[model samples]
Target: MKGLMVKDLRLLFSQKKTWLMYIMLCLMMSFSMQGAFIVGYTVMLAGVIGISTISYDQADNGMPFLLTLPTDRKGYVREKYLLCLLMEACGAAVGIILCEVTSLVKNGSGVPADDIRSAVVVIPVMLILVSFMAPINLKYGAEKARLVMMIAYGIIGAITASAVVLMQDIMPDLGHSALVKIKVFFDETLGGTYFWTVPVVLTVLSLAVMYVSYRISVRIVSNKEY
Candidate 1:
């Protein structure tokens, strides 16, 4: 697992100029885009770059050679998730720093509370996105994964929108009552600190989804001839 991680990290960082360009792009965007947008953009870049390592591994019949190493399918999936999460962390840190620096330059103050909230919110969101990408890439290979991802995201968006619309229409009274009770429970239990429960829940949910994705990827890779 450690060897796989090192190999992937080296593959990612081998192109120093590409990373420098990515940093430059982020720096430029920080001046023009919303701070929250910059955060999402940087983290998305990190996730995509991390996913690209799988392509490199798949290229030139490299999978057979990689499997010949100490790692197995499960270890490979675990390493991919770990490497992607690490890159996302690095990206988020870079983004927050840039947002802070830009805010200071613009108004001589730190980032706004809303921006800070958005920045923190992007972490689990990006993790979930990476989780989905990993399994799709593992199943479809890098070339087909982009198409699969687009379709999957489209389906998810449609379903989410439909659910929101249906919820608004169906059992509105019951839903409102349930929501009220839930809010009351949170307010009674966590009081003012209930606001943080969202992120904590999201983090746990994302980790669970990532673990499931990892298991699926292991199955996909394990069954493949290579």
Candidate 2:
């Protein structure tokens, strides 16, 4: 398992595309003038880059070659998931540092503690997104899985929008006050001192998801004729 993970890391580091994505992330970080913008970009980039890593294997027909080695199917799948989570952590770290530096230079201090707190909320959400998508990618390959994930995301967006619209209709008196209240709740509860727990829970959940995904991928691949 360790050898397989090392090999995957080697392949990831040696790839031009990987470096290109990193460069793009760095450039984006440099241009982000606000902490909110930085956080948004970081979360978005992490998802895109992580999904691309999975797609690269499918696109390049690397899976068959990887399977031919002594590595087991579970090890292969687990390694990819682990690598993606590591990439997310790295991206988050870079983004936080960039935001701090930019804020210090432009405003004498980086984004406020509250803004930083709010940004931390995205960490678990991103992990949930990745965890949900990883098994789909492993089971269906990149293209099909992407299509399914897009549909899923669309449905989720629609549901959320509908809920918001319905709430507005039901509580005309509240106007946007409800949203303000919800935001305050999130800011004070989820984004406050409890924020640190998000990463810890996300890490644990992601590992659990990876384990399950690994088992499923192993079962699928082991039955294949290749």
Candidate 3:
């Protein structure tokens, strides 16, 4: 398993697509520091980076070659999922660093430690999305999986837009009362007492998703005749 993982990492790093992604991530991080665009740029860059890693296998017909080695099919599937998790973690770390540096440069002071907490929330959600998508790719291959993902993205965007519109319409009547209630809820329920739980819960969920994805990928790959 360790040997196969090392080989997969080697292949991942050696690919030009991987480095291209890294460069693009760095550029996005630089722009994201501008404060006008915070979450959008970071989330988009992370998504592209995750999808590009999955595409690497399809582009090179890597599976048949991978099967030529002594490793089991299950190991290959597991390695892919693990690699995605690592990539997401790395991307999140890079984003955090870039955000801090950008805040310092623009504001003449670092980003508040509290606001940094909000930015980190996206990392786990990104992992969950990637975890869910990995098995889809492993079972469906790149072309079909890309279509599925595109549709999913569209649905999420539409939902978000609708929710924003509804909120804008409702906000006039709710006025300061709604804002006060939200503040009180956050202060009472979501304050420092439960802040640490977000990452803990997300980590646990990501692990569960990773495990299920591994099993499903193994089943799909095992049935294939290489």
* Better-scoring candidate (TM-score), 1 or 2: 1
Can you tell me which runs of candidate 2 are displaced by over 4 Å? 17-25, 170-225
Q: Which pairs clash in model 2?
A: none
lDDT of 1 by residue, 1-226 (tens): 9889889888888999998999899988988876567777878888889889999999897998999999778888888888988888888888888888987887788887656665677778989988888888888888899899889889999999998789879866777888899878866786566667766788789989988888888899888887
Over 37-150, each residue of candidate 2 has an lDDT whose tens digit, in order, gives: 576467657665766666777776887877778877766766767777777787778778777877887788767866675676676667767777877887788899989999
Q: Relative to the true structure, how large is the alpha-carbon lDDT of every model?
A: 0.84, 0.72, 0.70
Clashes of 2: 0
* Regions of model 3 farther than 4 Å from truth: 15-25, 28-51, 154-183
Instruction: Give the TM-score of each candidate.
Output: 0.84, 0.77, 0.74
Model 1, residue 98: displacement in angstroms?
Answer: 1.0
For model 3, how does the per-residue alpha-carbon lDDT over 1-226 read when each residue is reduced to its tens digit? 6776676567666879867876776666566555423543465455555555556766668768767788788777776776666666676666667777777777878767556666666766776777668777777778899898899899999999997788779785665678899778766787778866665677688778767767877888899775
